[model samples]
Target: MAEPQDRAQEREELEEIVRSIGRPDAFVLHEVIRRTGNEELRRHGGALFLSAFAAGLSIALSLIVPGVLKRYLPAADWAEVLVRMGYAVGFLVVVLGRQQLFTENTITPVLPLLHDRTLKAAWRLARLWAIVLAGNILATAAIAAVIAHSGAFPPEIQRAFAEISHQTIAFGFWATVVKAVFAGWIIALMVWILPATGAAATFVILLMTWLVALLGLAHVVAGSVEAFYLVLTGEASLHDYLWRFFLPTLLGNVFGGVALVAALNFGQVAPEVEEKKDADGTG
Candidate 1:
């Protein structure tokens, strides 16, 4: 009896780490997410915009939660670690809600293109990307403006927001791009892992997104909330928003998600896909 209870407690404490090793069947998972990407491409423009906008608005929790925590938590070695958990809250909402997040699009939609390799498929992927990216940016910009101008929070929380913005821009362009690459890689990896572990999706999202905040990596949508806040408050320039934050992070994210994760995973499964097609007389 004691042994079972002890194991249960251990699981509660270390649930995120239990399934760290061992991967799912890559080909099977690819097909599953590929179908998801296909469905996203077929969504009407209005529905896609609304979903992406919701995702942008939803991710605001990631920024706001950390800032609020920073304002209240006692400054200690472990305080920031605990505060970073807020990053997962926004991701949890975005992922689990099935909202159309742009970074997620970088990997999922590309799988369909890689498999189809047709002009029509490529065009659809590009269209989906453009709509989602535009919606995400517009929503984050709107929310940041409200946060900066609305004065809903106390001055202490506002200052915390400013500090977070300062940290986000402390890195130079190349440095931020590199960090964003890692951020993109992780986000795409999380998307890939989710279809495989339906039961552990929440833990995976929390662990991966929290890792982004803990490591101080640049994420295009989430980081833009801080950039917009800084710009709105006159602490940063519009040039800073474009040059210092947006451009590099976007490039890095696309490269990391499409080039590194999606392409490689597709490459691994391509031979098997072709083999199966030949076996079925569909090649």
Candidate 2:
């Protein structure tokens, strides 16, 4: 049996946590921004840049795995599903490896900033976003160039890369942007849920990524692989990719991850927290 005071304190603490989770407004967004800003600052630019690069490089494995599966199961219609599962490989590696991924940053750091609404916090998030996006794009391009030129994969796999490139081109600008927004929303949610999952984080990461692939959603870093491959092969122009795919997807992702998911998450919790604070002050 618990003491009366102890039980009361426990109930209060639980209520506070629950209230925090329920709010989805500016205050909560500010909190998320501040917390993420602190985390980014603590990690520093070097680690963040390197981790983002690693995430890009590792995520390229998703492209490769699907190609390998395609080669092995060339005739099977369902093989695409199995091959697509390989898309989760890089996500698992990055998340479990504790690397900084840009999508995750979109929500994580913003929470704190939203809560505080300070100029410094806003600048921090802006800086982090710029660095992470640049690093991720560069890394993805480098890996894609290497894969295209290395001859490490068989001709069929190379052909598969071309096929993936063509498919991306077919999506056009708006579709890609819309798909990327959805993907970013899902990825942000994944990050939000991860801290609570303990050892099951990897499984959750896999499930989320697999869903992204299944839904034909676009991811900036991951999509860069296909875009670069096309550019390298002379099949698709860099101008087209940059204008049609990269820029739109980038904007959409930021909007989806930050505005739709993170902001809303903050909104939901803010009211409950305010109510609890009022109750405490009155008591």
Candidate 3:
């Protein structure tokens, strides 16, 4: 038999567990921002580069899986939906695997800059951006080379891959820029929603990335693999890849992720930060 005090404590614990059931505890805004910012600051050059390379390699799955699906699925009209679902595969690997994705940096690094507003912070941000972008592109180019020459899949699947790669850069330069902006916006929004998602984070990532694919928006990192594939196969010129897709989409992603999402969110929370500072000073 339990003592009365032990019984009361057990009853309280049971009630607390019942109340907590079916309710996931989401991360608060400031804690999420701080944690991400701190992690970025603490990550060393090698770690950052390798993680980015891994992400680039992994994100290629987005293109590869969809191509495989396109080759096998019957020529039904609705098969496109299944194809789009494949787009989430790489994102799942990148996000859940805790790799460094450049687009994700748009939000995470910006928070630290907002908090500090110093030239050193800006320089750190710039250095991180350059390294991650270079690593991602290098990893992606390697995948493109393999896909073009390694005889990794059936010729029909390779052809489908090439065809899908061409579609990624089919839009005109300005059109791709606009589309990439939307892509950046969606990606940044996904980053914002992630901290609050808890166990449902995978669902959020899949849904957002699928929407990105379904809407035909441009994503710089994932799109890099496709563009490189076209280049490797002689289907697209290096000049066009550089001028049309890579540069334009890169700029658009920066604008969308930084200017639109990070800046606005920071602005919304700026007042609360100031109030807290004032309170601390008085106390």
Instruction: State the C-alpha lDDT per candidate.
Output: 0.88, 0.78, 0.84
TM-score of 2: 0.83
- Which residue runs does candidate 1 get wrong by more than 4 Å? 1-24, 279-282
Q: After superposition, how far is residue 263 of candidate 2 from its true place, in Å?
A: 0.4
Worst 10 residues of 3 by lDDT: 18-27
RMSD of each: 9.5, 7.2, 8.1
TM-score of each: 0.90, 0.83, 0.88
lDDT, candidate 3, 106-206, per-residue tens: 88888778766889989989989988999999999998888888988889999888877887779888899999999999999998877667678899999
Clash number for every model?
Answer: 0, 35, 0
- Quick one: best lDDT, which candidate? 1
Model 3 TM-score on a 0 to 1 scale:
0.88
* lDDT-sorted candidate list, best first: 1, 3, 2
Per-residue CA lDDT of candidate 2, range 86-170, in tens? 8899888887887767887888888767655779878888888888887888898999999999988889899877776566667
The model with the greater TM-score, 1 or 3, is 1
Tell me how far the alpha carbon of residue 153 in candidate 1 is from the true structure, in angstroms, after superposition: 0.5
Task: Report the C-alpha lDDT of model 1 over 164-250, residue by residue, as the tens digit.
Answer: 878777888999899999999999999988866767789999999999899999899988888999999999999999999999999
